[model samples]
Target: MTALGELQRLRASRGGPPRKRENKAAFLFLLPWFAGLLLITAGPIAVSLVLGFTDYNLIQPPEFNGLDNFNRMLSDERLHSALRVTFTYVLVSVPLQLACALGLALLLDRGLRGLSFYRSAFYLPSLLGSSVAIAVLWQQIFGAEGMVNQVLGLIGVQGRGWISDPSTALSTLIVLNVWTFGAPMVIFLAGLRQIPVMYYEAAAVDGANRWTQFRKITVPLLSPIIFFNLVLQVIHAFQSFTQAFVVSGGSGGPSDSTLFYTLYLYQRGFNNFDMGYASALAWLLLVIIAGFTAVNFWAAKRWVFYDD
Candidate 1:
């Protein structure tokens, strides 16, 4: 046969050009998410990176300032204070929040009465945690004449304006952050439920106490879930803006005690119209979060037990 005829015969024997129907279906399904990533996410990130090296206010065109913004941070006392506040908040709130969540999840895992109601009630705070209304409510709750002081008054323990005192203002915010433990609680409950009951039974037959089993089996198995929540909460805490902003009344006030990193960035960007500096701050935050996350993943190898 001629070469062309042989190729045609081979094609006929096998199949036509691959249609890639599955790939096309997957691409179709993923189109919206891909579009969002490019436009809403990646686009802004790229623009912000470029803007970080340039001086730009909303009223003027950007002028390249090289590393001025980053350099300015070296001498910025406010930036240091903001970083201190942010790190303190994250370090304190995340572990406490996770602890509260795990404790409540354990309590709920005991097959208690009205379990659904308890779960819903506990989770309600997380739903409203980031809302302006919640922050406003928090301000009232901790205000001198607010509910907290009112209770204190009955107990004859005088209270000051919790949100207005630099010393106590940050603590109130920390308390607020800790109160929103519901989301992680749910995750813990799910992880707890996933543990095979037989493991507990086996441990019991081996005369292992509750603490022993919990330390050995529960902690090891649940380490993965704990790691996941840790990473997410750390990132969330770093990016927190609304609570501090609303509570501080957009001032990061009471002696800058509530000046979270994101709040400082917002003040710089919009309030001061220092978009370039704000972009730099944003980039710094991105680096910090990425570094922490990388460390967490690295550290996970030592502790997080995966069944894989």
Candidate 2:
């Protein structure tokens, strides 16, 4: 029989089209989200790509600048600083956040008492840490005569302005980012629960120590989750804006020490009214993030384990 005839016969033998009742219901439920995705998400991206090639500020008509904005990045000193700060934050914060997340996940996996409460308490920071109010609170806590300094006074160790010093401002933000490890920790906990109890029991029968079992079994089994979180957290860290913006009072000050890439893009687009340059910067960020994510996927082949 011909391929199409055979496929039709096979389908005829099993069933016709699926019932539309449940499918129609699901589509109805999803309509709002789909509409939002098209209007809120996809629409802006199309406009921004066109903006990247223009010289429009809010006051003037958009004049095509071709590759001018992209080319200017080659010699832009502030762009370089923004890139360096962003890279440092991503490199330092992501690994530290993952490590803290993994550690907390492992702890919670031991089936401790009040597990829900502990998990909720740990995850609370991730829920609220990125809010403007939280960032403002962080600024106050890290100020020279703030809570940190007051605690230091108790120990007779004088404290410096953690968020005001050029050298230390970014570090404080890194800590803030790291403190929100609860999200990944929750994901890791879920991954841990999925592991078969029989695997650990089998390892125990072979006289494996806790360390050995964790190293050989838990680590291998959790590699896929680790890879997932790594990619997500890296992109998240690189795009961080609100914390740095609030901490530095939207100036990225203390010598531009907290100049995250997104903050710099905002400074160019809105503050300086250089919308074209800001749009270019936004696309540049997408390219950088895409490159890193591609590398991560390529690297995953070596370590990420799947059961097929």
Candidate 3:
């Protein structure tokens, strides 16, 4: 047979001009991601949506109901308490975190010796903030018998159990959030470096002092980055979980002082097996985050500057 005739024979045997083979390779490359998105992400999301309208224990088959879970949330006193606690946490932590970050970034912008080491050292806490070991360390540090009270004892200050005291427990978490300001600090450092040094030199020629230069040049230029960091830190603070969970022993104890929304949602869904109510709670959290982000974006129009 001629070469062309052989090719035709191969295609005939394969039942086409190899369209299936080309499709097979395409599907093979996409298989793992497809499976992961569907099974790992989309499946759970769809299940949660369905569960929001049902009564599910996760141990028993789900019993379908309409809007009951959401309606129950309206009068749930614990949900209100949790919302208040979470709002307090977000409002306190986000601004403090950003302020600390901006201050550190300003200090680092001075171009000092051993700069890289200092940068890495400062960022280390942020890298470790979400780790269980750090959470445990925080627990010990704020515990009644821990180092905080030890120093207080030496000075005759008589420090209370910071993590166990209802009034102080949430404050400890807020401090922890602020301590992890390193990530935003690094971002602000990058943003500061991107500002043209010529701007400062020109301001100097115009007889502007350091304070005047910063106000006229750096602050306006850095405002957008500040806004970006603010929005992200706000969202993260609102959804804070690990620190509160570990510190509060997952009970939101010391009179529910540390009962964050996510912690309460976990307790209702997984711990109590009330999946329907938990799903509704999760949706409510989504709405809260979305609303806050929208407000920030709307507010940014007035203040956040884009030099371009």
Name the regions of candidate 2 deviating beyond 4 angstroms.
1-38
Among all candidates shown, the one with the greatest TM-score: 1
lDDT of 1 by residue, 1-308 (tens): 22323543575687769875787889899999999989999888888999999999988899999999989999999999999999999999999999999989988986789999999999999999999999999999999899999999999998899998999999999999999999999989988988998999999999999999999989998988898889889998998899999888898988999999999998999889999989889889999999998898789879988664
**TM-score for candidate 3:** 0.86
Which residue pairs show backbone clashes in model 3?
none
- Candidate 3 lDDT by residue in tens digits, 1-308: 22323543576584645443577888899999999999998787777788899999978898999999988988998888899999999998889989899988898886788878989988999999998788899999999999989988999998889988899999998899988999999989988988999999999999999999888999899887888788888888887899889988899878999999999999998899898889888878878998998898789879877654
Task: Count clashes in each candidate, considering only residues at least 3 apart in sequence or on different chains.
Answer: 0, 0, 0
True lDDT of residue 1, candidate 3: 29
lDDT of 1: 0.90
**Candidates 2 and 3 compared by lDDT, better number:** 2
lDDT of 1 at 85: 96
Compute each candidate's TM-score over C-alphas. 0.90, 0.88, 0.86
User: Candidate 1 clashing pairs?
Assistant: none
Q: Give the higher-TM-score candidate: 2 or 3.
A: 2
Measured with C-alpha atoms, the lDDT of residue 136 in candidate 3 is: 90
Per-residue lDDT tens digits for candidate 2, residues 173-207, read 99999999999999899889989999999999999
